[model samples]
Target chain A: MADLPERVEIAEEGPREGFQIEPGPIPTADKVALIDALSATGLRHIQVCSFVNPKLVPGWADAEAVAAGFSPRGGVRYAALWFNENGLKRALAFRDRLSITGSVSLSASDAFSVKNLNRDHAANLDAMRRMTAVHKAAGVPVTRVGVMAAFGCNYQGDILPEQVVRTVADGLAVAQEAGETIADVSLADTMGWATPTRIERGVGAVRERWPHLRIGLHLHDTRGLAVANAHAGLRLGVDRFDSTVGGLGGCPFAGQKGAAGNICTEELVLLCEEMGVRTGVDLDALIEVGRMAERIVGHALPSELLRAGSLDAFRRKQAA
Target chain B: MADLPERVEIAEEGPREGFQIEPGPIPTADKVALIDALSATGLRHIQVCSFVNPKLVPGWADAEAVAAGFSPRGGVRYAALWFNENGLKRALAFRDRLSITGSVSLSASDAFSVKNLNRDHAANLDAMRRMTAVHKAAGVPVTRVGVMAAFGCNYQGDILPEQVVRTVADGLAVAQEAGETIADVSLADTMGWATPTRIERGVGAVRERWPHLRIGLHLHDTRGLAVANAHAGLRLGVDRFDSTVGGLGGCPFAGQKGAAGNICTEELVLLCEEMGVRTGVDLDALIEVGRMAERIVGHALPSELLRAGSLDAFRRKQAA
Candidate 1:
């Protein structure tokens, strides 16, 4: 195997992406406690919540309350996801305390784009430009655009590499037109269709085209290839990844009835640590947080690491 | 990333390795039917059964019956596991019909060897030498010695690469003393403690010391790194792997009930195929066989592909 990177960044989005999908609302206090527990686990960045329509995703209705209830740690950076003008307005309310993250989603499947965002590529691009302007005015140094369905899609199967490249390029152009820098480009495998080959080729294409942009992967473990694809991205020198505690949060649009969720944070950390790639997160603590997440969500989780204790822990027990 | 091998050889050991640990006996006819189903799925090699004490592993009491009942396909090879004199005696009864495999266990933790095999290193080495002589006398072209617990053991925490190298060397010496050739040396991660770095380094060390011997991996998905470890092995150009259909079976010694089974055959195939490494097994047929195995086992299996369906199938549905 090739030499792995010295360290990789794991951006936890469980509170936002994970909680937003549940049909039942999670109490703001519980969300704060979960985020606080995750913060102590050595995660550097946490996407705290999403500023969105309460009517559409009532689960995230307590986003402002969650932000207000949570305690911010010294070293950790808290982020929030916002999609449009209204979401940005909500995000701006807590801009003093939160590092804002706005996504300009380019849905390869027009049907998904219309259903999820009620907008097509051109409309979303225009919204992205306006969002970039708002962030620029707010002096937010980095603007992140999530390329939703960057891989394949439920409605539109087999999203070509060119489509991703074009979407990313267009997204960047809009950001640049608004005189804002594209700080992070996240290739969101919204339906968990990001295969290793697809990941490697997509990352390679994006890297070749825009070498300076920080690339991140928002992968779903619906097909159980999330870690494998992450490794593929790591092979291509992509370091940042978005994962959720306990593999929480499913894409309602992914069409798999909650089986598709962000890759498990602890599992991803385990994979990285096993490969000799550093992921400064404390695995044991992260697993505790995963358990807390399972309890908060009122169901069993899909994290293999959470179920099967870490090898180190097992080894320590055997030694004792 | 390094170039993957043009193709990989998947040796299915579900019948022997997967069924042996089950408490209830799988009917001989069902075993034969499963093998027959696997045979038609384009799997080139299948480890049909083990010739061991039925009292110890009643699951395999029908080994002979399973072998006799199943119809072997034209392009497939059948193999069986043999431990000592008794197993060899049983295996030799059908020597013309099956390729025989034995294990030279190196339990980093001595307690595991005692619990699983009822022998220490020196005693197993003596048995290995005797087994090699028997195979040599029978003119078996290849003698395979699986290095059990080559990765780590439940009793013994971590097995170092040096220990694995030493075990392989000692096993080779025994085969050489018997005037026999060791055709294959498999590093068996019985407890699924193997990580990617360990796999690459271990495989690399084995390749460096004995370049001629074919190296294979017998990995378990206990810790969910089996596929990742397989990818790591692939990056080092190791092409042969042992997998079980529907991810059935578990190591009684693995201490996790049924969580640590041989890497799922369809999952492994999917990983390889997605990485552009060829596996001759027919995936759809294997998935159907996986469903059959699940039904025969009277429970839901852990195979992700079987649950999520294949990308091609999903794409076809979407296109339709």
Candidate 2:
């Protein structure tokens, strides 16, 4: 309905975001195979793993091995999520893109911050600054500073738009002071509270504050608005999005069960394609990869495209 | 994003479309209770049930009893679906609004017509004309002419926009010849194959042909684009949408299972509310009604809103 972006970049996060909350352990070989299958589908960027504590997230215990085992394809960026200097050091060994994760709305709800990060608001900000400086010194090619709970906090009902702008501004100022050229600043809907209007407003506020910084959306399909919110972002000229295969991942911090997860990769691509936006993805291949992910996960996924198939799915049945 | 309509109307079809496909027979009192619950949620229009053959849709065996049992609330329109003279006569016993169903793309794919209606294209049109003549003689107050598979067909991949326009023209001519003033003409995506661009193009074509006619959309969330396509239609100024509580109903004729169903009522309302579009339906009450429907139907529904709860679902959890 609106003027869509010519093309959008899909960042695969199933291996990292989706797998982190899964109670069952996924073998490193399987993770690598999943990433490889995703790479073959022409996905240009994949967050293959996260460098977090093995005890905290058992699913990501072999993050380093998964990263080391991945066969990088040309033009595809392999990235990892890091929370502290140790995680960053582990990620630096094999990372093309490194992410420093923090929630900008930590101050809005201290209860969530304590449960989610085990740190207070000021401590989280200080850690974010220190992490940004360390990443700058390492001189990684691409660094994404993610502001989780940017749209709404789980403990906090409705986040004020000004708080998001302030967080982005302060984060950008810290990164700039460290002489780091930030590649992207992501707005993470950790609890899936983002609506289209909220997404538009949040994106608008960030763009107004830091017009030069590239913005990305890391959305969850908790209330079935991930794709809709993604569309809203696209209308506002956002081109980069984080999605998980088979709509995997749960919000451990929010104590959410298997209800809400990352936006499904195939579903997002289909949304863009149906809206006449180019995603540079092979839908059929992506669906196949999604099926492989679902099988490996040992359960049915939340993706509609994977379940419904393509528009031509019934052609053969009808012909027969 | 885009400028949304100031307000939109949601027509609840849980009792008719949702129940028709449910294999397990629901008690007449349960269906009545579900409709009564929905009516209390400020939903002004509810398609209570259809007057189709009880043998055809065993789930709707007590349609007339359900209609008789419902306590009609003020400002709510209780409607029924009717196909032929017998069904019309049944509906006429307590008529509010009647639907005359046929696809605009019937000629494009006779296989679908035969499978869905047990009649070919020409025969379906002739039946539609005859039905319209009978409706004129009975002098029903409101009649909705539905064009099933207006965007895409299960039998034939993509139905052209021109075919839809021609069907509407022909259907309108028949109704006019019979001296019956049609209240609404709806584009029904029975197989959930409608896309956003296709929806925009189809709605535009119909508007160009019949500028004065009230256009409505009957969408299925099979590919999860029902909401997106609804948004597209909203952008083109089509406001009336057919939704079911808990996103119930599967297409029995198309042989689809658990994929294509009516757009979930609460989710649609949430989408509209988030986009600054006003829907008078109460979200909390509607979600409760959805849960009641789920309980009576004895299964988990496809509604994300019901699963995710409301935006404030975590407030109590956090407090505890």
Candidate 3:
């Protein structure tokens, strides 16, 4: 096997993308401790909180407090997620201390968007453009912009790859006008309905059009194909991924509970390690963090590696 | 899409292969009910019980009584599993009413053989040869003889495909000498460690060497690749399969408790249906049987289709 890269950058999504979709509200201190422990794990980027309204998403009610209290390490780059101008204003409060990123949901099904986000695709794009302009004027960098639901939607059967390419093109045009550096472009399987073929086609289309764009994939394991899809993406030269520790996130609209945890970070790391891809994260330490998260959440987290441990660890136990 | 083939023939393995490795003894009444329900599901071939020693496998202590008391169905061919000359005698008691199938563990792994059946490979083959001689003397036909651990073993990583082919050849020679017809030769992944590529290679090897032999596949879903491997086998022209309802079987020696149920029957049927391969199994009815088995077992079974329902059913709910 070829040697792995020296350092692979993994962006943590547990705080923003993970916690925002969780049903009940988790305490601010507990969330802070979770983030703190995660920060110490050698992760280059950690999306600590989202600036959405507390009334809209009660799970992230402590977003501002959590953002302010985070103890940033020397090498860690903390980031926050924002939706529109108002959320961007809230996110800018921590701009001097941490990086800020913007995101928008681009649903293949208009019904899902109107029902879940209360806005259609065009309206969401318009809001993103205005937010980008405001961030540019304030001299805060819009590090990343993501397009969610690039794969098939729950309400709609198959999402065309062309639609995703067009959406990414439109987002790029908007980012250009705002004079913002488009740090990364991400495609999300928001409903966990993506197959490996669909991921390959969609990511391939984006890579073909935007060769220089740093691509990331956010997937859900609703159909037990998340890891397979992630592997497919990795083969296509897309490295950065968004994973919740212990598979914490779910689509509130889909209504399937415990839909397999976010591809299990330990499992992904193991796969990468076996394939000679450097992740720069310790498997044992990540498993410990998963267990800690399970205790804090008052429920068993859906991570398989925590229970199974690493294969090497298993072999070591047998030898002993 | 091409139309599905008519009259699908499946070999039900709940009684012998399913419960053989179960840690705790399942009640005879429950076992009897499971067989009756399985018979009612239009399965033409059912391996109802095994004639191994009760001391070796206490789970099959009531095998004779259960086999004797089972209500005979006209078209369904009930069979008993026999391991040696002693087991053949026990199987002969039910020979007039049902077909008798004998099995020999032809694994390359001595450790797995000792752990599973308390015999080495050479000893098991010798026992099978002697058993075949007895069946020939009685003018009874041996319905099936299987080569276990054909692809890979949990105890010993990779088993040579040639070893499997040679074992089948030896078993066939013994049956020919005894004047007993070898109705089918099965390749079993008793430890559930075979991948799709391995399935193609192993099954392809068997088919190429013995084109006249009726081939079968017995798979376990220990690593979530059972269905994919089964698909590979189907593509390789091996039709007969051994699947327990709700994938309810595990190897006692494998050391993992409650490994994911056999490649879930409902999931298998759904895949076959979508792929235009005829299994002649009702998806909805199979789900009902799976639920019944789950109830008898006093625990939820590991069938994804039972929880998710059929795709047609889901589409109906969406329309409703």
Candidate 4:
């Protein structure tokens, strides 16, 4: 309890995550509407769109339109995702609207790196070095290191906490050689193989080694244990999370169909608020945004809170 | 980690919990099949069906047929749920196959008692007393005290740890007056108002007061924190749990439609098995049964593990 944070910083990835895999041209205006609705909630950070090849990810072909379309609210930092130089250039085009920072992204498992990026750890680090140069050229500060499959990998077996620590070190080394100071590390449960014990070990190991760096968990609910994993991270004082409203996204490569996406933002808020951890996000307002996201997706995403509603609503009704 | 139990006792309630709320006249044979399948999953205890009024709960009208239908396997303790003498009489008819131990079931919230059972706390106590007498007359051992709405209530606001402790004491007192030596208590998150912190506090309070009686948790996944709460209980060494296969039930009166039910059996097994705690149940076998449950229900159930497959499955594939 003493280790839990006073508040958590949630980066909403619903717009980027949902549109990336939803198998729709999902009208660009609806996407902007959902982002606008989310902006109205007290969420201070939102990822508005993904800048990727329109041919490969047809759902996100209108990424530029979504980036420019949504009404950005003051005090909220809007971000975008991109992989290479070309994608970064597209994202930079919206510098006035998007919070343009860069990340040194690497994978802990060599197999996941090969499968997801067609590169092993060595080759991925070289790519990160080049990406770091690109960010510097574009004047984007590279301040975060995201280690994918930091908990475990589906292609590889159980991931050791040491492996995660090593991966973070490798990413930090890449940034260090480029004169970039990494302030935080985000561990991605990219394949959803994380259990609470695994989280405690993984997060514990990283925090012990990098005592000054902020740690975040980017959890996927592929196995229905995301909230538990998040709770485990919170217990260890990991104060940053990446979530999707209504659990809006799915992993295209988790080796199974119907695999769940990120942990739902509203559920995480309820968990934090119930535990006396401040989230700075309005619970009811976020829930309403979750419902709106569900409508835009034209299907129910994986959030149970969207259906059952926040406990505060019932508390209010009961008080009445 | 030292406080976590090495092994746990899971009371399988899928057949009863699922059948009661599924809006089915879900064929008695199908219900029997699910029970028979669960029986083979290494789960020791299973609640087969609820003996309730037919008109009110048309789904469980064939409770007798379901009771007489399934083949009772060796070493398995099968149980049934009942609220009054008629329901108890119906269950006693199949005492040769069912485990007939009774429970003093009461709700911590008067508002929930009134809304759910048409009685306040005091009246509900009288009803529990009457039910206890009925159990004693039938020579049934009332060995467990169950406190529903033990964590929180929708009709009444948040339930405190002290309130839960008082409710447990009230139920234990009822059993004591009837000369029923209770050995264990089960606290239910009846309306799904529990978070991990609430769980720690409630479980902490009860364990503090009794110190000798065994404690278990019956968690609903409403609002999606059931698994996290279960994890919290595991941290405190609560070794008994009640779960439904495929997350196979819904809270009909959770003041909302499409509310999720109990913590998933396979998900619980995954959480325990991954944490080095032993849950004799096989993950692959349980996931298969969860699929079978989905087929019987004619829709997807809430267990994401059903779709994602077990981590062990991926491990085997990876190893291969």
Number of the predicted model whose DockQ against the real structure is largest: 4
Task: Output the better candidate (2/3) by lDDT.
Answer: 2
Candidate order by DockQ, decreasing, is 4, 2, 1, 3
**Model 1: chain B TM-score vs. truth?**
0.94
DockQ in order:
0.42, 0.51, 0.16, 0.86
Candidate 2: Cα lDDT at A130: 72
Interface RMSD list for the candidates: 2.4, 2.6, 4.7, 0.9
Chain A TM-scores for all candidates read 0.95, 0.91, 0.91, 0.98
Q: Model 1 chain B, poorest ten-residue lDDT window?
A: B101-110
The C-alpha stretches of model 3 lying farther than 4 A from their native spots are A1-49, A64-80, A89-99, A134-151, A158-187, A196-217, A228-241, A254-261, A269-293, A298-309, A317-320, B1-82, B85-99, B131-247, B269-285
lDDT of 3 by residue, B259-288 (tens): 554556666566566445778777777778
Best by TM-score: 4
- Which residue pairs in model 3 clash with each other? A247-A262, B247-B262
lDDT of 2 by residue, A21-129 (tens): 7677888888999999999998988888888988877888898788878888888878777777788788777645433333222343444566677897677778767
Tally clashes: model 4: 0
| lDDT score at residue A62, model 4, on the 0-100 scale | 91
Off by over 4 Å in 1: A1-3, A22-29, A108-115, A134-142, A251-255, A258-260, A318-320, B23-25, B93-97, B101-111, B137-142, B254-258, B318-320
Task: Kindly list the per-residue Cα lDDT of model 3 for residues A83-128, writing each as its tens digit.
Answer: 6778878878788767755543465556567777788878877877
Better of 1 and 2 by DockQ: 2
Error of 2 at B31 (Å): 1.5
Alpha-carbon lDDT, every model? 0.80, 0.78, 0.69, 0.92
